[model samples]
Target: MGGTGGVALAGGGAWVGSTVAAQPAAAAAEAAIGGLTTPPAYAPSGRRPKYRRATWSQQFQTSHGWNAGGTGTASANANDTSVFVRGTQSVRVTTNGTGKQSYVRRTGMTAQNMTGKMIRLVFRVDDVANLSKLVFYMGSGSLANYFSWTFHAHSTTAANYVQSGEWVTVHLQWADVTSAAGTYSISAAGSPSTKTGFTDMSFAVYDNAGGPVTYRLQAVELVPDTATVFPKGVVSITFDDSHKSIHDLARPVMDSYGYSGTVYNIADAIGTGSFLTVGQMRSMQDFSGWEMAGHSYANATHTASYPKLTAEQADDDFRKLREWLVGNGFSSEHFAYPHGAFQKTSDGVPVDLIASRHFTTARSIISETIESFAPAMPYRLKALTGINDGSGIGGTALSKVTGAGGRLDRCVNSGDWLILCLHKVVEGTPATSTEIGKAGLTALMKAIDDRGIPVLTVEEAMASYT
Candidate 1:
């Protein structure tokens, strides 16, 4: 079996139940094969092997690979293709204009017990507003037992209503389809027919809002478990307060070590004093890469009674922020509560609105109090220690977040997601009263790089969890 959404559906499958801790791919394999609940396996101490064998890396560079079916028309889309990055041919699907305007796409495959294999599929949706929902499934040729999930390409429309498709490249990391889908309810335990086992792939889309939608399937292949299994101690170094110093000082330091960062901006504060200018934000993206999330619309800095914002007020705050972000070539998919404080009023406002509706994540001001270490369910509620001004007075030291070296060392060694939160990246002034000094920040970045772990922006790292 192969695998792996939000309403606005997770390109990543939905988190059905309890969120598990970060475990490596190998450990994930052992646990899935054995039982639903089991302790993690021995994590690797050093580097993972680079070599990989594709049980079958079917490069759909040409047509006529497998049988294509459905009410839609599947044709080789050399016109709209990813020739450079992903071979030549991309299969384009255009469904009929029915009420529940959708399509069916299935291709027969050789029968094999794909129980614990890490199944991977790749595709993209065009810039069409009518594109409502797309789902992929795996099952026996007869469509007896199957599993399905939704994916949205954050793309925009004619009126510039952007929806998860600035040309989204969906790399669905469906780990061990068995565990992902759940215990196979109906199975052919002893059957040996060619299509007896789950031996076919089906792709379908449901009721488009507008007319008909055309989505492109670049290619879909099954990856070895050793390839894309397990979670690592990923580092999402997020800097709050759109401080100018972040773009001026911090970016260079992080780039020097091949690292990137996320900024929780006060939409109303850009181009203002000591705040990030629009040009600098774009430059960081061009120079290296960056992520921008909502901090607050106007009130990035907290007032005296910070923790007590009403739910309606909080919604209004985030809404303004989202508007600014969307209007500025960005999607308001992430948010960081101002003052690093999480607020959920009993009337069901503020944090609740941010959590359920507004943002995908609500990062924590306090690192230790955070549930687990990294990539937890209320993932929006991440734990972060400071690197610069995040002194032990309030949040954990930058050193603590970096495991102070050994602990940081072991954190990566054992494969946990470590998110280091910082404010400013300053130089001379020991403004221990505020931001992190350049020296300490430099050292922390170095230690993190030495571990050979991937440094991702907050949005990028979230993909690993599901």
Candidate 2:
């Protein structure tokens, strides 16, 4: 589960073998999260730049089997220096019979302490005989962890992680290695850097087999902690089919706690007794943090009659509903396919323009946790239905609120959105209502407030993704 033995070089260039103990945990765990009182502010430094400037490069020589290649470069800072070596001009060696090695240089760097700062390294590989044992060395001549994907491979092996003939970006965060906080971890991006120490950085090309192999070096960069960007967690809630009970029973509880929710409105079903009327939807849209999104013009069942509806029919229905919402003073940027039914064109493109104009994010029954997928993926919201009846809302709602099975508790801990979809909040009867009465709803709201997770409407959540 851990890396093979390696070495670490202290600030004065003293080397230590891989027997060093792990550092203590950082203080971040003890710090309190202030609160989710407001949307996080965007500091100018957090923004990603449109284009990056090359800083350094190192190309590998073919002595170990690789052909000669040139290394290019880029960086976000001008004062930050790095090194470069290309295959055509440098020495190459072979590790065993299979891997290749190359010569590297350190230029434009000054020795300085980099104790708390975050450092990043990127490498580019044109080709590789095998990628099993790639490693990196700092200015102190200590080898960092081998560049393998054993821990992050999901289900694959580390040896199979190489992408030959294409640029691969690897990022290495020094903060995680140096601190107890686990704040830093190494990752790769497109190219390798030539920077060294704290003042200037440099990069070198080497093969796992200690022999030479040919490959191109694009660029390398050493970005400070302030220059790195991290994404904020996203939370989204959706209510299927604007059921009147959502407004009559759920609305009051949500509004009282200032919780926001998205109501998926079925155009033709609006006036039905069990469903919300068009007028009710328009009013909900006017409320703060509440949003009205399309579920379909008539709850079209794509699984049954998908091919029957022409492209124009589907487009027209979507367009009309969007126009109705916008003309009635609602945000027109969200929509959910009715019953999660959708169509794909002959070329695999969605027939409806919902994917084009308005819908920024779409939700499917993907997973229970938002962390399960990439943050950029459309959030997968889970429905808390009768599956957990024995222990879910069926148990004491207060116990459920503070316990593991509680929806709100899971959402807060995982930083994923909790979207509660309720049908008929019955006046009586445990079977129909799960017996989660108004008191239960109140208790749930209090738990959410105490946990410090902001409750925003679906529109608010979608805005963050777009």
Candidate 3:
């Protein structure tokens, strides 16, 4: 990599690479997740901006890729740093006593989309007494377009603080980018320093310790906050039909454990006498664990499966439901098929193409458990079995939902999404065929939560991958 003072400004088109291939959890997975897991509670962490790595070592680059620049002397900080996690080398820099004026930078990172994402830069100062401030950036335009600023905990007061000594991981969350592409302020830390709304095209590490200090850029990695953000495999628990059992029985249990589930609501059923009322639907947000997505504007009246709905009907129903939910303050563009079925239009078209046009994902359970490598196929996401497959009766064992010892654990080990599908959560007994009792549902969610995998709404699960 060569350091040429400034970058060659490219058009906004490079951002496409950084755009996440957002597939719906089981819509691709809904069809598949018939399952999703319950996420674990975040450990204690405050002040530090918490986040999870959307990516890590696989994308972590070497400091050798960086270019030398500034009054400071920059080189492969190889002598001082150690190779960790995927054979990557670190950069070492010796500052020239001038803060911010000295920096080692690397340009051309079109995939570093910092929009709703966070990037972590981990490093250590050989001498904490001498070096104090650190800055990591992403932007090819100019210093103003940078993303990360200060990693020191002393204050957001942008630099002149001491957080040195051991290996420190600094995280930067991108708020809104400045309207003027090239405008940014290397302002104080505590004060908001927002800029760079575009895709990251370059990265740079600056020494603002205020003097000549040598520091090792051990790793510039993306780390997720164990709190709020998830670390590994994903899960989603989907409750179809806005069933009263979901709000009454499931909600309390999920909330008590700090977990959440997705509820696919049928628009026409809102405010009905027996189903979730409009007030109840709106109030579901209070639990903060349930995601209300679209089931169908009007509940399925006939034996029509996905293909039964014409393109126009699918579009209208899905679109209207999403709009209605959003208008009612629900966050969703996800959907669920009335029957656990996926199909193609009459002329050999995957009916789910219509979902891609209107919803994020549409759900169906093509198989008992999803293929680990196949979660990305948004429209055909496979589902796991709640009751033993091939049996239509309720007397079957609820092994999938309850995990049956290590069943859910095996899925997590293989990195598969165990999208658990269930109908109602009853008290003493399951009210219907596919419904799980309260204790069974709680135990199922608990088992998944114990595994430490993230439980995402179907849509949230897809975003986690993309």
Top-scoring candidate (lDDT): 1
In Å, residue 291's CA in model 3 sits off its true spot by 1.0
Reference-based TM-score of each model: 0.48, 0.46, 0.48
Candidate 2 per-residue lDDT, tens place, 1-466, comes to 0121111111101111122212221211111111112211211111212222223323332322222222311112111112112222323222232333332334334454433222233333434553333333344322231211111111122112223322233333331121111222332311112223432233434444433344333333432331122111233445666778767876788788777678767777778868888777776667645788766665653233222455445555655666666666666455555434333332222322222333444444322222211121231223333211223345223454345534444444323344444334444333543334555555556766776767666556434433
The best-first sequence of candidates by lDDT reads: 1, 3, 2
lDDT score for residue 302 of model 1: 41
Give the per-residue lDDT of model 1 (tens digit) for 1-466.
1111111112221111011112343443323222212211221121212323346555445543544445544333433343212444555666554525243344466765543243444444444556655666666645555655454322232111112222232322222122124333422221112212656566566435456566555455554442233243466788887899888788889888888888888877798878998788877766677887778777533442124655555555656677777767664367776655553343422242233345666676533222222222342354454445344444445554455333355345334445667777777644453578887788788877876767888776654443
Largest TM-score belongs to which candidate? 1
Error of 1 at 329 (Å): 1.4
Write down the RMSD of all candidates, one decimal each: 18.8, 17.2, 20.4
For model 3 the local lDDT of residue 131 reads 50
- In candidate 2, which residue ranges exceed 4 Å CA deviation? 1-235, 301-312, 342-348, 351-354, 371-374, 379-402, 405-407, 419-424, 429-440
lDDT of each: 0.50, 0.39, 0.50
Predicted candidate 2, C-alpha RMSD:
17.2
